[model samples]
Target: MTHLFSKLSLYNSARYPANAARPLLEIHVLQPRQVFTLAAATALAPVAIDLYLPSSVGMARELGVDAGAAGLAVSVFLFGLAAGQLVIGPLSDRVGRRPTILGGLACFILAAGVASQANSLPVLLTARLFQALGACSVLLSSRAMVSDRLDPPSAARLFSMLSLIGGAAPVLAPIIGALLAELGGWRACFFFMAVFGFTVLTAATVLLPESRSAETSAAARSESPVEAYLTLLKNREFQLYLIAGGANGAAFFTYLGNSASVFQDVYGVSPFAFSIMVALNAGALVWANQINRRLLKQHSLLAVLRMSGRNAGLLAAAFALMALSGVTALPLLLGLVFLMVGSVAPVQANTLASVMGIGRARAGSAGALLGAAIFALGALASSIAGYFYDHTARPLTLVTAVFLAITSLALG
Candidate 1:
């Protein structure tokens, strides 16, 4: 497997000489602490989004807005995430990874502080957007830095490990937010995020080393961002992998957009109970991601992806049927949701590694484009789900099914 990755690396280097140069500090093996730090930094976006989820209803009522209108905060934040990656990916390539991450973290801390003080829906929405922008930098930089350090197979394994580590955020954030909301209202969630961002910023500044070499950074800076992206866009493999990744991501985003309403409003679960259900679902996803990492050692990434894709399609269909039939069984509904969401991990991990392999020289731009496409499609899907919510799970189920089916077809 290492030989295979070495051959692939050689092929990539032969194709993109600019990315072929060795960094000053070559990492033959990664320390556990290093992986944890990078994964924690990358987890910022999920934490920022999920940590305040339990407060959505309370926030809506406090600001005198409808639930659907409050949901637009998520959509706008996703849009900002997409837009930020477009700029930050290239900037990181040019300016180096560490500085860009620190700058973005500073912005994230400031935005979260501002969000805590928001007096209206629009103000909160704007603050969320800025917060997402900052988080996007962390996301892109972490992935790019990993790609810089490892071969494709190793990178894929690292991505899975990161997902496993970061998965705790989705499992824990909502529960924490529920407690905070109970004690101090929605604003408390934002305050917590600000403090969290500050901690990550300090840690990153003190511990994270610059991954991009001076020569490589200088070479990346020589090209215009548009040209860099255009170079990656021309690759056929990148396009297919991007589509696969984006479609899978849309399924998860659709779920995120409506799960709170489905559990709280439709199923009549209390806010605290809803958070527990969400945490359980996230725990299932984390378990599946770990399985994917193990499977990679035995099966090819593409093989795992194909199997997961089929499973996702079948689960999506079942979920849609259950929603349409108005199945009121919470256990069955949550089970289907769990399987469908879990199936995305292998697909996302493999497809992202494949996409990064294609444009190894312009990893930052490649990662940015991939992240942007996922979030852009996700924002669109989530907005559509929110708009057609109708206090039922139909919109969520239908959207998830469509995206999952698309991902299956794309992978096939």
Candidate 2:
């Protein structure tokens, strides 16, 4: 979309390349129509990230890089996610969510195109950084919109739904990524990503409303970003939930950064088998979300968070012990892995809802910081896990266990 023209003058350069003057079709913003759309929009992050998991080894081999460097791609994406949210979240409060997120989607599409053509690891990693920035924009915007419309209870249910939807992305991501990698190689993944980005952008451009109200924009403008960040930082409750979320997020990221390597390299699983295993395990998350939603009826938010944290901690610790014992049986590790991923739902959703409640007035900013904490902590943990890779799952499992303990301590 080129905005050289006024509201009526905007045209999609992607659609009508021969005529830059062609008007883009306007889809009136009927926001209730975007309910599933918004949740789907948030799925792009996992789609972008996990959709390439199976392709990492192929990508590394083609680029003449080692496994660690290839794994660092995930860490790189997390860093960009953290940085992007920190910059875009507060800005959305002032400028409005739609434009900020649309800009991000454009960046994502461009980066995916660049990644498809990248010949070196550096080029690919650079492209991934911008892609994460784009992903965070959608994620932050979608979360802010939820905050705009819902109270804590309702927000939790919606977030649970998001988890249920997002978990499906990983189920599909691995299968598609492996198939694409086999047929057309790793570059195919990026091609798919570019197409996905364009579709999301079009839908968002048409369906997304300006969720940031004029008064909130004015209020946001009253303070500098530094002061706005400081205000949130001074609140201890926000800090507690932020750390809790970050640690839990780190645990998940650690699993992601190393899971492929451990399964494919150590266990000698075929790419096809690996894809099915990942997909089946992902169902745990969907199941967990439904359980979480129901439990919210019987228990308090914090109570759910504590239970999830405790369960996740046990799962991670069990994974580490199994790895240390040289257990390579797919059934044992896969079951443990399923439980670990499942336990992520309540902790992440509840902690996130609690923080958003604390900073609802600054939803954009609060969402940004919370997202940043998760990604930043995740990047650090994943990088650390990648560094210690020893052709075994120990590195990933141990790191997940340590981070989940940190999360459990916060919940305690």
Candidate 3:
């Protein structure tokens, strides 16, 4: 890990000397442990959301609500995540990354604890929203910290690295949730999330370094969030990149909102089997992210985005056709979903790098906007898919295909 960081550091120094003046938390080289810590922090929201997915139906039954209302919990969480990023992103720039993250983690811990005790749909939804809000702080700040430390290309790689680490959350979270739900109940999932949040908070408080210096913090404070956002919005390239990234994210969100119901309720798969299926898709995503990191070494980011966007579109179309044709086989549908969703990493990584590159001085704001856009679109997609649930995967596939088509057009 030390050797890899040195190589990346040397490459960045040679490729972009301007980055030499940037305030990095690590003075010499970034340690692998630091990367893992930051990545884990960023994974909080996804882990929290995914960890409870397998228990959504059970939660609804226990809470005496409809499945749609249960699914609304996921959408509400995404909305909170979007809202939080809008606030936390700029706040991190003004106050520094470390404090912003710790503050967010604290909120997440409290929210998770609240959620564990929730006996009604409204209370559970509210708690999930707060949990998302807290997690977004860590998510946005982690990206900004990477931008603060690395140049555009290296930052892109770091984003891919973070995704690689985060991808595991989907794979493992559901399995854990399944076991807990089976052994204890849906509430046990929330209790586990609370404990996880507390652990991450402690680790971040002790190990995470502050990337934004006092000077940068002061300068960031001088500008209002509105002004910063306005300036970023004026950049056409950034807007394009944001749309492309958001579109791909929307596809993933569509899947997340509908997959559990489609696999478990519609297809009659057991919770354990459903967890394994989800893990398989997440494994594919992780593999694709690793491939994206490798591709970055030999190709331009835009080139990678264009290629990924095209491939994702093709895969989504194939999946849509399969769904519409009444083909409900688990293995076939899962394989198509794997390729289509896995294609997101390259497009997202490059688009984010482009967005942050345009506003190097305000990377936090850029990251916030990017994060907000992704989750906002995600919330929209999830809500639409969940509302139109027809006891099949068609709704999910159709929404995913539309988003993939949009992503392809945006990349072009």
Compared with the true structure, all predictions reach lDDT values of 0.82, 0.80, 0.84
lDDT of 2 by residue, 1-412 (tens): 1121221122223323565442222212223347557767888888888888888887888999876678888999999999998899888888888888799899999999999999998899999999999889888988887766555665786688777766778788889989998999989999999998898889888877677755557769898877878999899888888988999889888888887788888887777777788777777778988898889878888788778767766775786688678776778877777887877778778877888887777888988998999999999999998999888777887888888888877887
- The superposed Cα distance between candidate 2 and the true structure at residue 185, in angstroms, equals 0.8
Cα lDDT tens digits for candidate 3, 1-412: 4655876778656654664565556524676777888888878987888888888888998999876677888899999988998998789888888888998899998999999999888899899999999999888888888877666777888888888987888889989999999988889999998898888888888888788855557758789999999999998888888898898898988888778788887889888888888787878768988998899889988788888767876876786788689877877878878887778778877788888888878888999999898899999999998889998888888888888888888887
lDDT of 1 by residue, 288-314 (tens): 888988898898877887887678668
Ranking by TM-score: 3, 1, 2
Say which prediction, candidate 1 or candidate 3, comes out ahead on lDDT: 3
Q: How does each model score on TM-score?
A: 0.92, 0.90, 0.95
lDDT of 1 at 223: 91
- Candidate 2 regions with alpha-carbon error over 4 angstroms: 1-33, 323-326
- Model 3 steric clash total: 0
Looking at model 3, residue 317 earns an lDDT score of: 79
